[model samples]
Target: IDEFWDYDEADRLKAIEISHAYRKSRGRSRR
Candidate 1:
């Protein structure tokens, strides 16, 4: 159960990173 939680946390972080990068790219394109 602990391992699963850790994995989920890592996945959430990764998703956030991806979304952040995506937004940056979109902003650059808009400018």
Candidate 2:
């Protein structure tokens, strides 16, 4: 159970990081 929880947290962080990167790229393109 602990392992599963950790995996979920990692997945969420990865998703957030990807979204942040995507937004940054989009902002740069817009400018």
lDDT of 1: 1.00
**Model 1 misses residue 26 by how many Å?**
0.7
Clashing pairs in 2: none
**Model 2, stretches more than 4 Å misplaced?**
none
Q: Model 1: which ten-residue window has the lowest total lDDT?
A: 1-10
Residue-level error in angstroms, candidate 1, position 22: 0.2
lDDT of 1 at 18: 100
lDDT values, one for every candidate: 1.00, 1.00
For model 1, what is the error of residue 2's alpha carbon versus the real structure, in angstroms, after optimal superposition? 0.8
Which lDDT tens digits does candidate 1 get at residues 1-31? 9999999999999999999999999999999
Give the alpha carbon lDDT tens digit for every residue of 1-31 in model 2. 9999999999999999999999999999999
- Per-structure clash totals for the candidates: 0, 0
Model 2 scores a TM of: 0.91
